[model samples]
Target: MKKWLLNILQCIQDIYQILKEIKALYNQFTIVTAHLQTIIRLIENYNHLAEEREKTVDTDQHQREIKLLDIGQVMKILNISESTYYRWVENGELQPRKKGKRHYYYLFDLQDQIAKCKLKGRL
Candidate 1:
């Protein structure tokens, strides 16, 4: 019957539409995955560079000295914001000591850290 033939054609059209949609989604997924992979590679390269920079300047282990640095002072010295500094502290990226209900960074180790972070921005 004509009705049955029309119904079958509609089903085929619907299937084709679904297939096209799925292919579009697959392409989008590939693009997103490629972007993520590129970002990961860039992060890995930065980490490698940072590690190399840290290792290149060999310092003796016996010359240990401690120094205290304030938030604003450290921010100015490192050219980073208070939020970023605190984030680094929270993530254990930067080691901070709490004293008298305040957080402080060690000045002795900071010179090296500042160089490592490549301190950016106006803060």
Candidate 2:
């Protein structure tokens, strides 16, 4: 009878240890799940921002297709570097419109710059 009780007590202790391990695993799983949820939320927010940007770009493109030139377009048209562009802006040679964080120039302004360059024998 004594031996049988000792065996039972050992079995109970083993079960308790297994329960503690299970509890630890559950806590870890919960933490992982929370992190995954946060990641999912961040991705969703990024996607939403991307979609909004696409819509804004599409609208701007449609409205300013031929009238407005972005920095890259202006650079390509003038064959100038970014530093030169900013220098021109600083010198009051080129006036650009600001929308959000981007700068846009009018097609007429670019034509004027080109004519000035030709007159100065720079182009």
What's the lDDT for residue 39 in model 2?
100
- Candidate 2: stretches off by over 4 Å: 66-123
lDDT of 1 by residue, 3-118 (tens): 99999999999999999999999999999999999999999999999888776543422223345678888888887788998898888777767788787866665766666767
TM-score of each: 0.46, 0.53
Question: What would the per-residue lDDT of candidate 2 be over residues 1-123, giving only the tens digit for each residue?
Answer: 699999999999999999999999999999999999999999999999999999978876666666778999988778779999999999988888999978998776677788877787767
Model 1 TM-score (2 dp): 0.46
The lDDT values for all models are: 0.77, 0.87
- Model 1 stretches astray by more than 4 angstroms: 59-123
On lDDT, the candidate that comes out on top is 2
- Candidate 2 TM-score, true structure as reference: 0.53
Reference-based lDDT, residue 97, model 2: 91
Q: Tell me how many residue pairs clash in candidate 1.
A: 0
